[model samples]
Target chain A: MPDSFDNVSVSTKANVYFDGKVVSHSLILADGRKKSLGVIFPGEYHFGTADPEVMEITAGACEVVIDGTTETRAVAAGSSFTVAANSGFTIRVTDSPCEYICSFGTP
Target chain B: MPDSFDNVSVSTKANVYFDGKVVSHSLILADGRKKSLGVIFPGEYHFGTADPEVMEITAGACEVVIDGTTETRAVAAGSSFTVAANSGFTIRVTDSPCEYICSFGTP
Candidate 1:
């Protein structure tokens, strides 16, 4: 059996990475402005729930705020969070850059 | 205000394209085989609902099979379909290659 999925094609895709306090390869809009970029903070902060769910992952160690609640979750490399569609939250990173994949559906 | 959203990052992403009857830049698994590959037929086929939703799009003009029901929907380039999480079904493309994005979460 094939190891990966086949019979699919994607066009115009990009990769991005984030370093604590810095963002790179962020998605740009028609006006050439960064769109839906992720930020890595030195520590976790309070992020209230909002529309367009927010997904977060900690490349290093960090904490997260979900739906007005606070939790100290141990986020490791490659770990991912699927923020409910149209949900709100906040995240704080410690020790290293909080890396993750933030994508949007076709508008 | 920025035209697009901001404060997000993505690492290691890819795009694929379809040309009515061929698949390219498909996602590979550890086994080096095509897993869950999409096929483009001359016309639309029936696809039942299954786990791990399947997303489909039409690069050219075609039809689709959703949740065991056959529906002739107009699919255009750049349009995308988000198959419900863990759904199963079949799709038959007509006139052109039925293009779409098939991505899997980290295992």
Candidate 2:
């Protein structure tokens, strides 16, 4: 099958965070849906979301500690996890850089 | 220092090519510029551009034969090359997957 969202346009600015350990490109679609495609270098980070998000691991693996959870979950490439709107999560990249696509949805 | 264009927004749509060997996310910045962040698997491919493009190798390496040259040049991670508008080029990825950001410019 073809890749997802192959028909949309992209912006020129990049969304960078955590002292450049996390870098992403922001996207605005024709229908107004927003998303970010980025790569995270090996590190630990905590993030909060305003909208519900579907975080897909496009490449590499990482461990996540989502809200209400004390244990960490292993997330590998080709796998995905969702976070509720207004909630938060912690991600730890143990090895290689992790590539991801964060798709935002209505809360 | 910091990564380039690290504050722009991206589109929700993805730009897939060569039957998934090349996959990218499109971005449309607030300033109206366009770019695509994607990865290219190990393979040879031919491409043509409608606008001048700066192909930056963010991770990994690849070889490129731009319009005027028949000799392929090595492009490792942290390096880049340029192609003029309406021109075409051929790229060969001899080893690992090549991660790139193709930035478009005025003709």
Candidate 3:
């Protein structure tokens, strides 16, 4: 995975959820693709998606179950999972915060 | 303050402090100036700096006291505080999460 993105636009404010249990910074790539870098504290979280999304684990680990799926898979750093458009997933972090980059509009 | 920054480089990994009580995403401007966008949860935190920094509160509020100082000031959203190079500051968030943009090496 790329360490950083160059020539992008970034928002200063954060997108806080679950009372700051989950926090992320929004950014736009030079090609206009939207992405968010986020941290999920030790807890379970369910997120719905509008566009087709890809969640890439950057640090730590997480167990995820895609909506309508029964199997929960453990995703480690440098791994990723995908969800269909208009779908959702449930993610759980055990002891440490799980960090990820969520890319929206992935095909 | 500016809502967002363009033509920048952003890293995906986060900087977690105080056991995730504070989280930030590092970035660099087009001119190679370093900056970070961060979220501070409801707690007190002390941070030392290697370079002069300007903390711009983008959302929520905080009380801050620079290192070696005795005065604590209430800084609301859209306001800022400066910390000198080789110095530090103490920040406290009472009820809600505080969001900030820290610009490093400021003059």
Candidate 3 structure quality by residue, lDDT tens digits, A27-67:
99989999999999999989999999999999999999999
For candidate 1, give the lDDT of residue B44: 41
iRMSD (1 decimal) for each model: 15.4, 8.5, 0.7
Q: Model 3, B1-107: lDDT tens per residue? A: 88899999999899999999999999999888999999999999999999999999988999999999999999999999999999999999998889999999964
User: lDDT, candidate 3, residue A44?
Assistant: 92
Best of the candidates, lDDT: 3
Best by DockQ: 3
Residues B1-107 of candidate 1: C-alpha lDDT, one tens digit per residue: 11221222222322212221222233443444221323343654544444344354524445455564567556665564545545555555556344444444422
Residue A97, candidate 3: C-alpha displacement in angstroms = 1.3
Q: Top TM-score: which candidate number?
A: 3
Interface RMSD of 1: 15.4
Residue pairs with backbone overlap in model 3: none
Query: Model 3 chain A: which ten-residue window has the lowest total lDDT?
Result: A98-107
> lDDT score, residue B68, model 3?
97
Q: Per DockQ, what order, best first?
A: 3, 2, 1
What lDDT is obtained when candidate 2 is compared to the true structure? 0.74
Task: Measure candidate 3: CA RMSD.
Answer: 0.9
Question: TM-score of chain A for candidate 2?
Answer: 0.90
